[model samples]
Target: MNKHNAEYYISKLGLLPHPEGGYYKRTFQSEEQTSDQELSVEFEGKRRLYTSIYFLLGSDDVSHFHRLKSDELWYYHAGSPLTVHVIDEHGVYKEYKLGIDLENGEVPQVLVPKNSIFGSSVKDEDTFSLVGCMVSPGFEFQDFELFTQDELLAKYPQHQDIIMKLAYDLIPV
Candidate 1:
């Protein structure tokens, strides 16, 4: 078992609460913006070209199913393995394990495509995972959408098990 608990790391890293669940702190934001003229219609307005955050998930916490308009990259930092669950727009479900165990097929980083519903949790119940997330076209509140259980189930009935497992609202927060 890990020597440190979630509270220890939270205090050490000065992380704040994240809307999608878990604790996080914005680590970087680019000053450069994607000009309105150059941005796609999906984007509401101009946004910084990049942004990143230090994300942490305790054994009791789960990053809920949510979708962003911009692509996101996840980098594993420490602790137990994290399982990132993704359900693409076409209803395809996939899971990516983030950890240092390359021999066991765990990858240190993963890219979640834009508009794909995604969530994460520590694979080991006794441990926590610290990670960094980078978003391109920078993150904007207008580009984020939290999933409702009903909406997700209706769209992807085949992935019911995972949907129920990862949807934030379905579980105690």
Candidate 2:
């Protein structure tokens, strides 16, 4: 058997002992100190892992398209009436609404594969959700690109374009 320092072992395995801070308001850890979300890690010393847990304070309204390089998991630990919208590369789109009042404690998990455009919104007053992303080979902050409503309007002056892309009626942010 051989002995290795903590940092050496960690570096060899590309582990992130400490999850990225400020990405979420709170976090949880395992007894071994592994993160509940594993928000970030090192990637062959080339890139940093990117992970996040979204905590909705109370029925937040968010509408922005983010293109992700890695797969992601959405875990609903609490709340109800969660909605997820995904757009594929072929310009196809669909919506998935989850949870009845009884599904609040059921702990449903949804996975979005890599190379998909996605966004979400919470409809219930007490609704909240957490998301986890596992970016193979690591992820970087620059990988995230947000397309906000204003940018959409500027790019597509036609009302039908907005509806086709986002599936909603835009009344100015």
Best by lDDT: 1
Q: Which candidate should be chosen as best, given TM-score against the real structure? A: 1
For model 1, the local distance difference test gives 0.88
Q: After TM-score superposition, what is the CA distance of residue 70 in candidate 2 from its true location, in Å? A: 1.1
At residue 118, candidate 2 shows an lDDT of 66
Q: Return the TM-score for each candidate structure.
A: 0.93, 0.52
Per-residue C-alpha lDDT of model 2 across residues 86-167, encoded as one tens digit per residue: 6665556666664445455323556666666666666555344333334432344555555645654454444334334443
lDDT of candidate 1 over 92-113, digit per residue (tens): 9999999999999999999999
RMSD of candidates 1 onward, in order: 2.3, 13.2
Clashing pairs in 1: none
Over 4 Å off, model 1? 1-3, 170-173
What RMSD value applies to candidate 1? 2.3
Over 4 Å off in model 2, which ranges? 1-54, 98-107, 125-127, 130-139, 150-173
